[model samples]
Target: MKVVLQRVKSAEVQVDDVSVGQIAQGYLLLVGIQDADTVAEIDYLVRKIVNLRVFEDSSRKMNLNIKDVSGAILSVSQFTLYAQTKKGNRPNFMHAGKPEYAKEMYNLFNDKLREAGLLVECGIFGADMQVNLINDGPVTIIFDTDSNY
Candidate 1:
């Protein structure tokens, strides 16, 4: 499992000229699932995302988690995160999980986040989505379940 987290003043997802999900002030999560990913990985990623201290406190320090700030989450499925571009000019997506598996994990991930008491919004899985966001502080981070970074 992998995620690209961006602290955003606002974010939204549109499909076929229709807005499906949107958030005012929160995080936009671009999520990717691998073949080896399981519920455990999903659990870990959700915990980390919610508890991430990207929001600032009264002292202007990034010490508050999303929950502390009453922020929301916009989750979008992005299999391209697993794209392997080390070979030829074209990138290979062999590492990306199958569509069915990806969908399952994606839904589970969002459900878990909602269960944690955060208002969650999501893009249609497997749909071509256009995401818009005003990145707060331009703060972004890439996180992986398997890697220690």
Candidate 2:
């Protein structure tokens, strides 16, 4: 499991020229699921994301979590996060989980986020989506279950 999170003033997702999901003053998440990912990884990430203190406080310090600012979440499936590009010119997606399995994991991830008390919006699991966002502070972060960083 891995997620790329960006603090956004606002974000929206569209599929086939129709709005699917959107959020205001929150984090936009690009989520990836591996074949080996399970509930444990999802649980860990949900806790970390909700508690991340990247929002600015009165002292101009990044001291507030999403919950403190009543922020929401916009999660999108992105299997490309697992793309293997070390070989030839073309990237290989062998490490990306099988579609059906990945969808299950993706759904579980969003469900966990909502259970953490944050409003959550999501793009279709396997649809072609166009995302728009006003990045806040351009504060981007990555959380991956396979890495210590």
Candidate 3:
């Protein structure tokens, strides 16, 4: 499992010129699932993302978690996070999880976040999506369950 978390003032996702999901003042999560990913990994990431202290506090310090600031989450499925580009000019997606399996994991991830009392929006699993966001502080963080970062 891998995720690119971008703290945003607002974010929205569109599919086929129709708005699908949107959020206000939250984290836009680009999620990727690999073959080895399981519920345990999803559980770990859900906890980390919700409790991540990336939001600013009254003292102008980045010390508040999303819930403390009443923030939401916009989660999107992005298998390209595992694109293998170390070989030839073309990128290989062999590292990404199978579509059906990945979709299941993606849905579970979003459900976990929502169960935690955080409003979670999501893009279609296999649809072509257009995402727009006002990145707050341009704060971005990446996490991968298979590696120590």
TM-score of each candidate? 0.98, 0.98, 0.98
**lDDT against the true structure, each candidate:** 0.93, 0.95, 0.95
- Residue-wise C-alpha lDDT for candidate 1, range 24-98, written one tens digit per residue: 999999999987999988888888888899899999999999999999999999999998999898989899999
- Expressed as tens digits, the lDDT of each residue in 2-27 for candidate 3 is 99999999999999989899999999
Off by over 4 Å in 3: none
RMSD of each: 0.7, 0.7, 0.6
Relative to the true structure, candidate 3 has a C-alpha RMSD (angstroms) of 0.6
TM-score of candidate 2 against the unseen true structure = 0.98
Encode model 2's per-residue lDDT on 1-149: one tens digit a residue. 88999999999999999999999999999999989998999999999999999999999899999999999999999999998988898989888899999999999889889989999999999899999999999999999999989
lDDT at residue 145 of model 2 (Cα atoms): 97
Candidate closer to the true structure by lDDT (higher is better), 1 or 2: 2
- Which stretch of 10 consecutive residues in model 2 shows the poorest summed lDDT? 82-91
lDDT of 3: 0.95
Q: Which residue pairs clash in candidate 1? A: none
lDDT of 2: 0.95
